[model samples]
Target: MDGPPPLPLREQKMNSEEKSFLLPKGPSRLPVSGLRLKRPASDENEPPKVDRKRARGPLDPTKRGGPVTAAPCFPKPPPAAPGLRSHRQAAGSRRTVAAAAPKPAAAPAAAGGGEKKRAPWDLKGQVSDLRAKVGIYKEKAQGLAGENEALRQRLNQLEGELKQATARNQQLEGQNSALALELQTCQAQATESLQRVEQLVEQEQQLQETIKSQSQTIRELESAGRKAREAKEDLAAQLEAREAELRLAQESLAQRAQENEALAARKAQLEQKLHESEMERRSLHNAVQELKGNIRVFCRVRPLLSSEKEAQKPGMSHLRFPPDDSKSLVLSKAEESHVGRERKEDIVYEFNFDQVFPPSSSQEEVFEEISLLVQSALDGYHVCIFAYGQTGSGKTYTMEGPDCQDPSTAGMIPRAVQQIFRKAREMEAKGWKYHFTANFLEIYNESLRDLLVLRPERGSELEIRRVSQCTEELHVPNLCYVPVASEHEVLKLLQRAKANRSVAKTNLNERSSRSHSLFQLRIEGHNANRELHTSSVLSLVDLAGSERLDKSLSTGDRLKETQAINSSLSNLGLVITALSNKEAHVPYRNSKLTYLLQNSLGGNSKMLMFVNISPSEENFAESLNSLRFARKVNECVIGTASNRK
Candidate 1:
């Protein structure tokens, strides 16, 4: 029932312009035709054909009028004239509807309001209005046609732009899909990077711990290095101090060395003077002994044995020693006189000697008196000491010591050997060197035998012979001359000789040396500093005891042994007596004992004799004979002793 509202002014103006463009400005050029009026179709049975053009007045809906009937109010034209008539009819009908339909409704309302209405059948005026209306409608149709054209063009342009937008939107959608995928990939990479970052953080922590420990170790090493440097400096300072002290010590040592050299030189000079003085003193001492007499005799009275003591022997009271004199002894015995009266008389025989040892004297005291004479042998003098007495009188004990010799009771032979060896060592300081050789021999039954030989050849007799024609020195041809180095060696030799010496049991004594035993030590000395050499012999003799055949009750071999011993002893006494009288010719070769002692009894030799006496009345005669012979020997002055240098 309502029409669309009018367009805006800009649209209306456009429409007007379109109308002006579309419609001719001038009047129509065609010949004017008369309006042909036709009857309205009264066919109710057939519907009227509507003029669709007039019903749809403009192509634009906004300009269209109300619905119009297809009722032919205009003329039906011939077929040949279809176009013109149709156009006219369409226009006329549209106008009628436009003008008539509203008028009727208005007419009713007007009538009610008492208003005048135009009658429906005013033909002429209606025609004129319709004509004018037709013209207006035609113009509007033309405008609408133009508007439709313009609208179509605009729609085409918009469709083209929409297609472009659609294509662009599709392209943008594809780009968005790629970006989404890239975003997914980026998210995955970021997640992986986050995980890697976590691992790196853990490694960084471990590295930090390592760095911390290394730093601690470095600090410790630095501390140690600093201490080492300080210690090195201390050591350097100590070394410097030590070097200084060493230098000072070296200087002091040099000074001390020089002083020691000078002292050594002074000591050498003093030692030389001392040696010279010692040599001179030895010369003087020997000279004093020479003046004392070369031949000296000592008397020793043996103590009564245990057997004699138990028996209370009468001879024990017969022997006597002077109270105030150590050099004199007396023998007092009661004797029956047959010529004058039948009464017992006390006969006193007194004797004097160089020295007399009483029964109380020790072997040490006896050796002390003979030690000086023994030393004279080392001083290049020939020295002889012998012990002579009857059987059981201690002659062998005094000369060679007891069978079981003790150091305290060692005889003259062992003591003399020890003294010679000791003095030889002491003389080494004075540049004297001595070599010693020893021989032990015995005169058995007028034959010379080597006591040192354990087993002698049957016919190998020892003979006393001169060493050479140029000198009077004597030696036994077959005697064993043992080179001895020490006193111990000589003592061993003495023991061996003692074991081999001749011994026998006789009526006068159980153990009596049946042969004369002689031990001789030959000393050869050299003084290299003084360019001097000397040779000497020391002869120690233990003579066989002289026993009376009647007293001993000896027969056979014992009687011969006794006779030989007595004869040699008697010759020994004769030689001493001749030397005491200063006879021109001394009978030194009468017996083996005398012949072997030739050099020792001469002027160039020193001699000592020991008369060992038994303090027993049974041996009174033999003891007196020994004492008298020793006294004769003591009184003899052979000569001043000389050294064989």
Candidate 2:
């Protein structure tokens, strides 16, 4: 029987369900099953056929075209009952038979127009074919089940990988952002570095220019240094030549020095000869003064006083200086004649002295005459010079100047002091040194007093004593003997003595010296080169005014002072007169003044007396008395004085 009239051609092919059972799944499905289905060799060249709808299932919006998740497994159908199974099998058989059968076609067969023919039916053949197909389907189904199990395992693995990949991707994204920020920072740093590089490049360029200029300067300096070195060499050569010339000059100087030394020796010899000549001259001069007489006298006539001139008193008409004789003074006094009518007769007296000074004579001119005698004292001769005169006769003014400070008015004492000191200094060049000791004393009321003492104690009398029993030299005990270094020192002593000496007002003179003042300088000299030494004393005496008591308007103390002064004066005159007559016993101890001057008045001494006479006519008799006493002193010839050396 024809199997259900041949099925249509469309029905004869495999259905969609069967095709799906045979096809592979989409790309999302894993082929986890080890079993692979191989296509028939005849289909190798053909493209694979897939169902579009199943390949692109419902997609998740969030996932886009990503993988799809595994589907859930469905429960398998249970085995059918035997009879049903057989019936299903027969149906499937019938389908397969129909599919295997060729399509019916209208052919030239069947000459009978339109007579349909039915093929012969084979039941066993159909059953066999259906069983084989059923077996193939069972095998495919089992493989698909196994593939699904494997696919489930593979899907779990892929899901774990996907999660890991997603975490890694997020981490990479964070790192990328960090790296981008770092890139931005690095870019900013690079920009700053480029700017710094530009500034450094500018500095380097400037430094290069400076180096170039310095290099040129160094080259110029080197050239200058070479020139300076050459100049230094030339200077060195010139210095050497100068040194040679200096050596030659030094040699010449040495020769000249030798010649100068010879000249100096000659000069020394000449100076020695000069010193010898000076000594001879001093000796000759001393001999001359001795011949003139050791005891000498000088007469000085006092100038008329201003009071006499103002009162229109009788002028010094009685006193006259010889017109041609400097050594003589003529005194003429007009006396009344008793027999005639008031006719006055002239009594003329002429006195001669060693030197007579007129009113016009200067102190200097007077000192000049005695300066040589003063020098004799330095030659070891004891010298005594005294001024003897009546009151107000300029006796003090002659011995000591009215103003000792005035060189023009300075008298014999100051002028002699100056000359002594000056000569001492000059003699120092001759290897002579002189030491002087000075003492000033006054005889008041016939009592010895030390004028150099600042304040003399009341009733303290100084006594004259012999310096040694073997010598006639006399000195006053407790007298202040000062060592004098210069003339100024001696002058100061003179001033001090002048202040301390006794002075009193008298009718004859307002400020009459009431005491005899004596200044004595002891000179000791040494000449080392000549091995000579000399010691001598220079005595200067200013005798008290010798005015008669009646003329002096004496009373009480004044009368006593006048008597004492007159006694001392008379004693001095007696001593001179005795010496003149060559009396064996001289009255030296009769008064303090005479005894103290023992050595100076001896034969081994030089003596000078200044007889000062007043020019006033009222004092003519007193002047005459002083002149007579001085003449006696002048006439006495002491023996030749010898030097102490």
Candidate 3:
């Protein structure tokens, strides 16, 4: 078969930039139909040229336009140039290549007698030497030509700029000389003016001195003439008055001596009585200090319905300090006050831990307003917010919202937990960090069960342990404290507990808390400034709703449970009543509710009570009793230290 024709340079330019080892295009890339050759057109058939360049893969820009001629192509590729092939096999492979891809249809290279001639371009042994010398000379010529052009352009620009600079410099120099002359002339004029001013000041000083000497001489003559008239008038009056005054002086001395003796006696009597009265006052003050408890009392009220008469909205029975009367709340001796019946919502009055309500109109809404007090606890104070409300009066809703995620309907517990974690995070300067350990327990079925605890059959019998923030002590018999970091974690815990809570569909709360559930959070941390541990106990307790036997269809097991819930709540009221009166006996041990809150109701704690009241007409009596019990609680004073007023 004949070798392929030489490819045209025009086709090579099309794929010049692609990286190819030899060539990317095939031998047929040329205009095959327009093939120009020595053969006649009559021979319409000839073996087609195989373009081996197709297998070259890609092209390289560096290997662009160069001489190309077909070489012999065998089943195998041509042998490498000269040193690239071995001596024994080089001649045979070269012969095969020249025959396989003949340079062109050049009359078969005029077939020599024995062997075909090789094309001049295929004489690699001769072209290599010529290519190396040509490359070096070409690079040198390009670099010199670039430098020559840059120098010519730079010279022309510099000459033009130099002429313009010279002209500008002359103009600036002329302006500077004129300014320097003006400065010199101004200095001379200032010096002359200064000399004239000094001369005028000296002449004025001389003239003023001459006038002052003349005025002094005239004043001295006037004083001498006035002294002569004064001497004659003084001599006449002095002689007559001296004789009469001597006689009266002797009588007055005798009367003054008697009066002095009487005054001294009266002064001694007043001093003796003053000292006795002071001693009595001090003794009483000391006794009062010993008896009185400085408990902080804050009044919190819930909103009333807009349609109700203003006077009945809060039920006048819940008022501690009259709502419309600000002066009464500010009074040093305000004993009783009126409740605001102004249009609002369900009314609740929260007071101190040791306050009592007589159930009049001034009842305490203990759970309704505790966010403010709990917020203060996060600010580094031991705070306790307890609910004192009848069952079914929204107590559970007040402390721990049944719907915890909703802030508007939030009860005390979720609100308290949210505030504590928030304040702890905000205490940046105190290097304050608070670890919250949550323990949800309920005094239910008269037995303590961890609400977060798995049912006995569902899981192992987990222990309920009490944790002590002091001395890092933890663990309680029925309550286990779980450390929580965020509000979301608390909410999830609440939701889980609510699901696990022993709820019965009662006439009151459909999912009423059957037992006293204590959601206790133990807050302990160090103050950023003092670096000392500050600890507080926070409890959001939801007492089971109070139910009327007549209205409730509860029986059997339900009745017993209701009885247990009521008995414990009653004991709670007694405990508050005893504390309010400063009674030596606080019945904390009377019930589980009171016993659990013993520390909170006593010393150094900021205790607030929310008496949750449901304005529903059906629950009014229980609400009224609840308010009266709350009012009694308002009178009790719990002892505390370090309250930020």
Candidate 4:
């Protein structure tokens, strides 16, 4: 062992301790290890005398110094590293020897060994042991590095998974946003649809009400239309019925025309036979020439009444007569006065027939003496039947006959119609169509008025007046005569004329005509083939009764009427007397009475007179005057006679 050839660990341990003793601890270790270590102590905490860097690193656990910096766990004298001596080998030889000198001989050899000889062996063993420990630390550091790498990989994978989860959350949020929008839109649409539905429901209800009203109205209209159609059908049926009646009338007209033709043919044949007979009968010509016209005259013979019966009979008979609706009348003193005076009279027969003839007369008799005169008129002759007598002589009766206002007597007017109709039927065709127009007029104070158109309330206003034919100022104004077909119609006219007459009672006669009444029938007849176009004028004159002013105690309107009557009667007598003598100055225009009698008194007219007289001696002078006037009228030779066979 020759002084233990310098042990490597012991040598270093010795050198290091000596150097650390020589120098201070500093940045040398850190600079060598390439670490920028933290400063061990702050500047203010270190002792002023001490080197701060050296003191801080040597004692601090945070900053190791010298050999400790490189190997912190290396024992200063690491006890006995593994199986080797601890301090003896690692420590310097100088330190080892010095330290052994102080130790006991026996203990020092067993633990530390001899300083120079044992150091080599101890150094070898400690070096080996430190190498083994360093190898163990390297293994631990490798394990830690592996664990760090594994943790880093795990962190990267977890971060990647978290990013994907974040992206998924964002996508889910987007989907939720879209779904919410769609839901909102759908909800809005549904709301709108619901509102629309509500509106539709309301409209439907309104339509239903309207339809109900319309249906009801339509029903009513249909009913009305049906009714109208039914009415139209009824009207059509009525029209058809009227049309049928018209057709029937046409057929009847045709049949009547045929019958008329047959009658006309028969009449023509009869006329031919008569003409032939006339040719064969030349010997009868002288007889016919001598007879020119057949003058057949009829006269009436009335029974005489005593003076007592005559004066009282008018009152009793008038009282017995029926009341009349046509006229409001009363019996005047003149109506009660007969031709006979109170005790005695001159005229013999009572002749008023107004109370005897009104309604109907026999067709055969027609009248007592007037049928012949009517027949003459029909034969194209002018015939005038004049009534000339005392005041109560029934002059109206003999001319036109009386109305139904007198209940006892049927009038000559009715009889006249019956006779005319009978003769018309017999004559058939002499071209004898008679258009008869009747005019009833009256003359009062030489003035003329229509009698049938009198005011009903005023008897005085109903006075008659005479009218001139060719006068500029007309008096019988606005008088129209209607065609009368039957006897009944003429009778009605007579009644109406009488009802409207004005009568003023005088002592001379009861119911004296205050005015002259004239019923003129202007007949238009065509009969030239049978020698008869005779437009004849038939005048039925009812004169105002003639009376002696001495007998009639006339007063007021009655006196004026009496004067007019006297004047007219005087004029009438003068005209008749003049015509009897064939005088040129006939004085026909002197008064209305004479003017009206122009044709009847003188012209081509045949006249008849009716005389009613009293048997009593008191009326003798008046009766004689009337008779003499009548006789003068009869003697008038106005013209040659025109009569019919």
Candidate 3 global Cα RMSD: 48.4
Q: Please give the TM-score that candidate 2 achieves against the real structure.
A: 0.59
Q: How well is each residue in 49-111 modelled by candidate 4, as lDDT tens digits?
A: 421111001123122111222211222432334345334433543443242121223221222
Cα lDDT for residue 424, model 3? 74
Model 2 per-residue lDDT at 409: 93
Q: What lDDT is reached at residue 381 by model 4? A: 49
Model 2 stretches with alpha carbons more than 4 Å out: 1-268, 311-315, 339-344, 456-460
Tens-digit per-residue lDDT, 229-260, candidate 1:
56556655755654554454344345335534
Q: Model 3: runs farther than 4 Å from truth?
A: 1-369, 402-404, 457-475, 581-585, 642-645
- List, residue by residue over 270-329, the lDDT tens digit for candidate 3: 333333332333233223222333343332334444443453634534344544332122
TM-scores for every predicted model: 0.59, 0.59, 0.43, 0.44
Which run of 10 residues does model 4 get worst, by summed lDDT?
24-33
Prediction RMSDs, each to the true structure: 80.7, 75.2, 48.4, 79.3
Clashes, model 4? 32
Q: Candidate 3: count the clashes.
A: 70
lDDT of 2 by residue, 490-577 (tens): 9999898888888989898889999999989999999887788999999999999897866778999999999989999999988888
